[model samples]
Target: MKEIQQFFIRNFIAVPVSFGSWLYLLFGIGMNIFPATGLFIVLYLGSSFSIKQIQLSSNLKQLGMTRSEYKHIKNQLTSARFKVKQLNSFYGKVRSVQAFRQLHEINTISRKILGIVKTNPKKFYYVEKFFYAHLDSAVELTSKYSMLVNQPLKDKDLKITLQNTRETLVDVNKQLEQDLRNVLSSDLEKLQMEIDFVGVTMNRDKPVLEMKGDKYNDRK
Candidate 1:
């Protein structure tokens, strides 16, 4: 059933319209006037509308999302994934432990953020906003720093800029962690509140005894 639904989502535009066109062709052969032109128009319109309907229904069923919401989340994930790949590639080229260490940390956190987005796409709006705000700049800075480090010349200014960029990337990694925490803040808060409630109840309802002259008396 899942495979069938996936097939429909992928081929909804072509399959139905093609089937209808074939049927129309078969029937129109017996008629006095061939309806080739009309059939083409109907098939075109039918495919366009069917594509939209299928997309909306698929989004709702798969992600509990509207068409636009699903598209937005999907595009954001794609962009984030691309940035992660870029960072990972740069990490490979890095020779200095200091630079590679920060890039590795950034790559790990970036991948974690992507995993969170994939697992809970509905909760991805905050993550998407954060990615747009800071992720691209981090990628750009890392790429530039990697290029500078690879150059043979030991220019003092270039080294200074690279060190500064490395610090900024460290901050960016921290920002990614904070952003992920923000996305899960509601769930974390709920969990903490539940724990507190449990602790209070446990303490309040705990068994107590009254001692009378070394003899314990149970108070029911």
Candidate 2:
């Protein structure tokens, strides 16, 4: 949808540039309609494509990554998004209100983690387990839990399995929370460093101001 919007904007901008020349060739120069139409189409398409490539390069530069690195990060994000979608799908299958809420919490955490890494593609490295194993575990366990919860028979053993699944999901939720912390750790560290630097700068200036105040008082 975003791409479509961009394409529309690009072509809208490209139209006047291409159309004026095409019109001159067709009407003013009395050129053949068929050839002029062909040239116009080619020019229009080429201009739009150039606009797209320029925008793509600009985006890659802003992200501080090469085209290949950007593509790799994008692919990883796409895969991670699919896993999150899978986790969300289980919510409807969940029978118990407790189970539904549990799945919602897990999905919420997954989304937060995904959103953070997405904006800073470099943070994708910080969440290997999240992209690979931990998320898969959540989806798989949820699948089993959802399936079993909807089963018609609730035997003694089945009840035990359900309880175990719920307990396991709690553990998975904790792991997801840990994953969120892991992704944010560097950001948190940077923030604290900034805060400390500001504090130290203020403290260092305080003594100078105090000495100046003392001199001013003596003169007074």
Q: Give per-model TM-scores.
A: 0.67, 0.78
Q: What tens-digit string does per-residue lDDT give for candidate 2 at 1-220?
A: 5557778889888898789879999989999989998989999999989999988797678778898987887887898889889987887899888988889988998999888877787787788788888888999999999999899999999999999989999999999999999999999999999999999999988855465435655756
Model 1 misplaced regions, further than 4 Å: 1-64, 211-220
Q: How far out, in Å, is residue 13 in model 1?
A: 20
- What's the residue-level lDDT of 94 in candidate 2? 90
**Candidate 1 on 105-219: residue-level lDDT in tens?**
7777778777877767787876765678778877888988888888899889988987888788878878877887877887799999999999999999998765665555447
Highest TM-score: give the candidate number.
Answer: 2
Pairs that collide in candidate 2 are: none
Model 2 clash tally? 0
What are the lDDT scores of the predictions, listed in order? 0.76, 0.87
Error of 1 at 17 (Å): 20
Clashes per prediction? 0, 0
